[model samples]
Target: MIVMNRFARRAAYFLIIATTMGAVLCTRVLTSVHAQATAPTTDKAVAIMDPTLISRGEYLAKLGDCAGCHTAPKQGAPFAGGLAMGSPFGTIYSTNITPDRQTGIGHYSYAEFERALRDGVAPGGKRLYPAMPYASFTKISDADMLALYAYFMHGVLPVSNRPPETMLPFPFSQRWGLFFWDTAFVRHERFKQDDKRDAQWNRGAYLVQSLGHCGACHTPRGAGFEERGYDESSRLYLTGGANDNWFAPNLTGDLGSGLGRLSPHDIAAFLKSGHGAAVHIVTFGSMVQVVEDSAQYFTDDDLNAIAHYLKSLPAREPSGAYNPQSQKAQEMAVSLKTGDVEHPGAGLYLAFCAKCHQTDGRGVLQKFPALAGNPTVLALDTTSLLRLVIEGGASPQTLNGPPTRKMPAFANQFTDAEIASVLTFVRTSWGNEARPVAKRDVAVLRGKLKK
Candidate 1:
């Protein structure tokens, strides 16, 4: 009996070892296949050094906002890729896209580059994190992709700077898991024009959904961290989302919290100039980067089409709107004129914000953005407000016009509590009924900006 028991125990131990080994082997095989599957089997002379193609590539790259993320602040080389982007899991560093033979993408063939853009697959079947926005880039046209490849390979000056490696924790660190994520969430498809829509609408849809990758920041994410909606059919599409401590306000035609009041021309003008000519609206926070880098470069027709498409989104009405004649407005007016000796926020607002924004909270037309009736001010998310207050910014400079003015960065000037108070005061006053800003929120953004 003792001998039999010993043999059984030994058998059980061997079984456990076999199972573990099988798991490891399976993971390795799957990961290998995932990486290799997207790699081109044959080398082809796919790209030619044509100036026109290179110029087109440059335009496409601008549309893709490549430099905004790929170039680190104060970095010497563009696309040398040392920018540190914060994600829910961890900090992910952008990779070098410059065509340097050693550290950059000089070694990447056209096929590899295309695969990386469209499939999120790096060379050797390595899966890139979704932060790369390949989910949206997958919809770019084959022709555009070709041009982009030529630009990166031949037009761009190669840089050898290697960014810091990304280090994620535990399961996230294992890139094999990203394979399943891709299969479930990513659509490896090209843009298809809808026959029912006009050419202009289709063009708008393509730009918004694909090359522009607007949903990357604007759309809310599902439980799996994928965008809740990629197409306009879904209600969650372009309804707004908070990313990296800034809230991208709703692009939908929601009356109170979205762009319902803005006309198609107004929207187009905003895109072209980063501020509406008629409305007292200006780009602030993270959107400043988007406008400066991408939107300002859009062609006139494309801008109009984008505006038309966005304005066509169904309007969402707020349950209630704040009254302009509220007690809060009266209090703010008193504070602005005489300075609220009791409230620190009022004093700060009057001192720092009253000049450009005006004492009445109606900013100078086409110069300063109005605080009153502003969608961003009244949105449920206060991140944008806090971000703007902490990191003062300017509107995008267009070919025809620059920003009327720039707001100085107040990060060092105000304490977290002070910033929170001022933002809260702004939101509460001037008929805006959004929630009060918290010190914690200001602190978080301040910390991130410092980093």
Candidate 2:
């Protein structure tokens, strides 16, 4: 009877232990969920910052392209958050970053701000997807970081807005799921100068390798979706790769589709102005968006260093060149543009594009960008030109800003072959050698039109 009683006592003990463990687990999870659901900060400190500091912060903020992420697309107040950024798992919407006391960063302490930038961790410890690019911001100098905070706090207008819900797949979306990713991926710190490099090189490195975060888009990500080791440490530094069906060209100084020959001045000019004539290329696709908000406002010195630094970067062969010389591709290029009739494509271009973009293949400055030596036409990333053709053209929005006559979209007026012919004629007409795009290419792109 006594032995039976002892056995019962032991059973009760085990039950109590199990109950305790389960409660602790439940508490931990609940706390995490609660924290993620509520990210609250006030704007008092931000409101108190000096105007000069805020101005400096404003400049740095522009450099960071804060509007690119924080701003809502088309409908909402700027930086009030409604932009839907797609990730492999699902869509992650940007959060409100305005100075709003109730809905934004008005109350975040400097430390909290720094942690978020460097570690991709939200104030209450939510993991931001790499889409936020805290990985690159991790390397930003503290000075710049402070200035950015200041600008957002005082220089900019505030909107009482919160981002829409961020959606992710089941367990993957859980805030707890982020714990593993955070532990594995995040390293909160700024860049330390590489003593081996010169001051100019180091400064340039800091900007591109860190604040510019060029690699988030330019450098390829790994299977886990983190940057392929976020710095120049890996040879894949600026090497190109395909992401989400979009191709990122190699930025290493390789001559073919790379910026090998651009002088520092050229690089600076291109970054500041968005037109690089010598390379016969212009920023397009997402890059044009970058110029509209960020690079154009950079100081000339920073621009030069970036240019000098990028030009100095050695060229890399990311993949075998899609040789136009190949038997199949070469034949394909020839068949697409027989130039059979004095066609409407070339005819229309002769009537329209040639006047501003002359038959001599040069463009009228401030009126039309040069097509002859224009870099966008020659780029391996013809996505820009194609997007321009389909969606119409865009002029640079810079210090001088665009003169306001936006390129009109001609989605309905031209056939795929006609569009291809006009582009081919321009590319080949003025020593600009590129593969002639087939009607099939245009037809393929036509299917993606939103309108």
TM-score of each: 0.83, 0.74
Error of 1 at 198 (Å): 1.4
Q: Write the per-residue lDDT of candidate 2 for residues 226-324, one digit (tens) a residue.
A: 677566667777776544434556777765456655566667766776666444345555666678778988988888777767776787653223233
Best by lDDT: 1
In model 1, state the lDDT of residue 266: 80
Per-candidate clashes, comma-separated = 1, 11
Candidate 1 Cα misplacement greater than 4 A, ranges:
1-47, 316-345, 397-399, 409-418, 438-451
* Residue runs of model 2 more than 4 Å from their true location after superposition: 1-52, 73-78, 86-90, 169-172, 178-189, 240-250, 277-281, 318-352, 371-375, 401-405, 420-440
- Where's the lowest-lDDT run of ten residues in candidate 2? 317-326
RMSD of every candidate to native, in Å, equals: 8.4, 11.5
List the global CA lDDT of all models: 0.79, 0.66
Candidate 2 lDDT score at position 154: 73
Number of clashing residue pairs, candidate 2? 11
lDDT of 1 by residue, 1-451 (tens): 6535644554454344444455456665565467545533333253347788899999989888998889898744789998899876678999999999889999997778888898888888788989999999999997888889889998899998989999976556778667666665777788999999998899899989998899999898775678987879888888888788788888988877788878888888887777876767788766777777788888888898898889888864342245678897777677667764466487788889989888788898778889887888878777777777767767766667654478887888998888889888788777777778889988776776772
